[model samples]
Target: MISWLMLAQAIALGAIGAVVAIAGIMRRPFGDWVLGAAALTFLTLVVQVVASIIAPIAGAGPTGDLLEYWTYLITAVVIPPAAVLWALIDKKGEWSTLVVGIGILACAVMVYRMHQIWFVQVA
Candidate 1:
């Protein structure tokens, strides 16, 4: 993981969390706007995953186990989409937004762990 990319990941997670929180506060459903924000936010994870894979090919891989790092990365990627799917199925209106917000917060923490795991071997 490059230093700048890690910083971007942090900022992305923060923004994602903030967006979700705002949705909940505004009593916004997982409608078009919310889903759009989620897609953009999830793009950050996609970028991270791409960099993770390419860095190894370019001999800039993380110091940690590749399997472990990718595992965390994959899991981080799943969170938002899964929550979105749930929101679509759930009929509880704004309550579904609460679930989405909480899920995004959880992803933020998970992303932090993924960042830490990148240097596990070094530590």
Candidate 2:
């Protein structure tokens, strides 16, 4: 994954999360925002996956073993959909909010992992 793109995605996800939190605080229904965020994240992951696949074929520097990268990629792709689905099932007050919060937390963690991967490569 491109470091700049990863960072951009993280920032976007963070913004989405913040919007979710604000909506929750204001007692607004944020299901649409949640879904939108998930869709956007999914799109970003698609780009990351394609880039990762092509990088090796283009004879780029070591990224890591394909299996290891795939593991991270799959997890990144799965989390948002899972969170959105769970949120949809939970109509109870604050549950959806919790889902968004958790999703945001996961995104933050992924961003850190992406950074770590880049750091390892640079070292």
lDDT of each: 0.74, 0.69
lDDT of candidate 2 over 1-123, digit per residue (tens): 567877887888787767776676666664666677777777877787787778767776444455555677778778878877777877566668657656765765676575566446443
Q: Per-prediction TM-score, please?
A: 0.83, 0.78
- Give every collision pair in model 1: none
User: What lDDT tens digits, residue by residue, belong to model 1 across residues 9-120?
Assistant: 7777677777777778888766676676567657878888888778778987677676777887888789889878888888367667766776677776767777777765
Q: Candidate 1: what lDDT?
A: 0.74
Q: How close is candidate 1 to the true structure, as a TM-score?
A: 0.83
Per-residue lDDT value at 79 in model 1: 84
* Pairs with steric clashes in candidate 2: none
